[model samples]
Target chain A: MRVVREIALHVFKESVRDRVPYTLVFFAVLLMATSYLLGQLTAGQEVKIIKDLGLAATSLIGLFIAIFIGIGLVSKEVERRSIYNLLSKPVSRRQVVLGKYLGLVLTLLVNISVMVAALYGVLAYFWFVSDPSVKAGWETPALDPALMVASGLIFVELALITALALVFSTFSSPLLSAALTFGLFIVGHFNADLKRFDQIVASRPVAYLARALYYLLPNLTLFDVKAEVVHGYHVPATAVVSAVGYAAAYIAVLVATSVFIFERRDFK
Target chain B: MPAIRTEALTKDYSTGFWRPRPSRALENLTLEIAPGEIFGFLGPNGAGKTTTLKLLMQLIFPTSGRAEILGRPVGDVGVKRRLGYLPENPYFYDNLTAEELLVYYARVFGHHGSEAARRAGELLDLVGIGGERALQLRKFSKGMLQRIGLAQALLNDPDVVFLDEPMSGLDPLGRRDVRELILRLRERGCTVFFSSHILSDAESLCSRVAILSAGRLIATGTVSELLAFGVGGWELVMTNLAAATVARLGLRIARATEIAEGHYALELPIDAAPDGLLRELTAAGAALVSLNPIRPTLEDVFIKKVGGARERATFHHGAHRDHREKT
Candidate 1:
């Protein structure tokens, strides 16, 4: 575990010193522009647009961060032959996999946290300064507590994709890993839809395949609470817990599979 | 117990993606190095020196046989903690400064906070890279990278250190420094096993060396033992021998060159005695400036052993000989 922590911290340090987190600057600029431009909407809808756009941007940026950085975690070391030195240490392959996974998770968490904070800061201005007439028609206050619930779930979604990217990175090229991870992310989002595809499709073979896939692919939409948070609807405590638990289980399996492959690999 | 030992250690790599073909990279490599010995793994490129080192370091699994360090299996964590390895053409995270990279490795070895920092500083200075400790690795030259790689390998004060092609990118000065460093490690009772194609470095540094060729262990023995394995021939240098006198002995002489105005260098067979030649030269009004027996160098033995390994050079118990190429 100590080895895992050391490797994880080193990965985090590497990502920080690299240009990976420089994307945060882009996020900051986009937020400012989002606030100024989206303000053109009718007063009440303007706040709604900001909230919706803010959450959407956070999720999108987090997806990019998780996929891009996570895909390089192990593959970069292998490609550069740096893994030779690290693996020579007392560290286990499993520790390396876990450390890299958590490291990218740390990077994603920090980036998302900043975006979440900036989004709320934009909403805070509207909360304190908006016209009473606009506030009256608002379904929720600009600084809604439900935003935290939504942000946490968004992080959970990103963490799962990070683990998936890491597993692909253990055996594949970064380009392929990114493509596969992003491909899975797209597929996972539509996994819940696949359940009903069998009802809409004509062929029995296709319906059976869809039925099988509905259980295999992640139901990523379970973590999305953007609309509910924007409209002041309740996000159940059970749903948030369930999403977090599902991510944890998925990450465990992915990491184990990564370690299994890494242990058998020959760094030729 | 030997500090390092491998019993029939072999590795076969599969080439091609669709229809994989097994290619033997190392085969039946059996070796041992006692404590505190500077052992050199000498081979030309593609001769499986790196593969053997990689096998010892456990960077790759062996297809058959086994290797042990400190009398523990290769997978033993406690044993691993007491070992260190530097791979050929080492690379580190490009964004890390020399200091941070060392500190990170130190922490991996279980040192904490300031101790890790202190060790990092100490190792950087030890490897003569302290001045560049603040510079990122990507900004470093090849020599600087090699030095940092050595620093990291020795960071743990391991009982045994394996360095693959340690001289790959070092300048003569850097090579000398590394040679001295290896000597220091021996003085501290640490076993240093390093691989290289640079025979000169191996000749000057190793107490013993194994010449590997064609993925096979061709020979292994002490420097003196290898040199003594075969005496190539003797070289005779002389001056004041007239062309008329040289012509008279041309039938007896193999080949003669006028190295200077009147000086001649000659090649003699291993069985030839300089006494008879000296008598003839002295009677012919020639002065024998000096007479000495010429012995084979490590490179000579290396070439012979490498050639032999390729041409059914049966390994007898040591670094071997078909003799030397007489000049």
Candidate 2:
């Protein structure tokens, strides 16, 4: 466990020094700031516009960072031939996979926090400085604590994506791993549609295949409470608990499979 | 018990897309290194020296074989705590300074905080790179990189150190420093197993050596044992001898060159007895200047074991031979 943490800390140090994560974070903050400008044009709906666009920007930028950096976490090490130095240590392959995953997740967490804080700042600035009549007529407070629920879910979703990218990176090249992880991210969000199609499809074989895919792919849409929180509707406690549980379970499976594959690999 | 041992170890890599064939990187390599001996693995490029090191390090799995380090299987992670390896042309994390990189490795070995930092500093100093602690690995020279690599390999004070081409890419002085370091390790009773194509260094530094050719062990012995195994030729010189008289002696002269004024030097075979040749020279009225029996060097033994000079000429690129040998 200590070894895993050391590896994690080392990877974190290495990753934070890279320009890619910093660049992504810069764009993410810019997009959140742009949402404030877009909010200004919405007139009476400034708060709603800011909330919706801010959450969307946060998730979108988080996805890019998770997928791009996560794919290269191990693949880059192998390509640069640095894996030789890393693997020759007393640490096991399992520890390496876990450490890299945790390290990137930490990076994503910091970036996500920055975006979230910036979005909240924009919303707060509009709430306090806007016309007095406009502030009185607003239904929800600008600094809504409920927004954190959505951000938390996005964080969980990003963690799952990061774990999946690591699993692909264990055996595939960086390009292939990126493609596969992004494909799963897209397909995962629409898993409910696959189940719905199974109910309406005419052919038995097609229905069975659709049902299988529904269970196989992650239901990422479950984690999106942005619409509820943005519209000032209460997101139920049960929903948040379930989403967190699902993300945890899925990440566990992905990391375990990655460890198994990595342990058997011959760094040839 | 031997500090290191392998039983018919072999590694075969599959290649090609459609008509793939298995390229054997190492074949039935059975060898041993006793405790407290500096064992040298000598081979040209494309030999199985690095492959053997990889197998012992568990960087790659053997196709069919077993290896033991410190009386445990190669894959035993616990055994690695006492084992250190320096790969050929190592590539380390470029983002890290020497101090940070060493601290990270030290942490991996269960050291942390000031202790890890102290150990890291000590190792860097030991490798003669102590002054470069603040510099990132990216800015280092090749020799500096090799030195840092050696320091990291010794982070845990390993009982057995496996160095693949430790002398490669170093200046003559750097090479001398590494050779002396290896000697120091052996003096401290650390089993140092290193591979190199530089036979001269191996001849001077190693207590025993194994010469590998085409993924196979061709020769294995002490420096003296290998050199004395073959009877080398002889050298002879004559002064003030007439060309006609020298020709009349009827000796198989390896080479005959004029030395000083009216003096000639001749190289002869070991089978050509000096007494008979001396009598012939005297009868022919030729003055004998000098007669000496030549001793073979490791270079000669290597060329002989690896199918002579022609094969040695093309032995540097192992990957290229890996393909050709497959077909």
Q: Which candidate is the best by lDDT?
A: 1
Residue A44 displacement (Å), model 1: 1.9
Q: Give DockQ per model, in order.
A: 0.81, 0.63
iRMSD of prediction 2: 1.1
List TM-scores of chain B, every candidate: 0.86, 0.81
TM-score of chain A of each: 0.95, 0.94
All candidates: TM-score? 0.92, 0.88
Docking class of 1: high
Off by over 4 Å in 1: A202-206, B235-267, B275-290, B311-327
Q: Compute the lDDT of residue A184 as modeled in candidate 2.
A: 96
Give residue B13's lDDT in candidate 2 (0 to 100): 84
Native contact share for candidate 2: 0.72
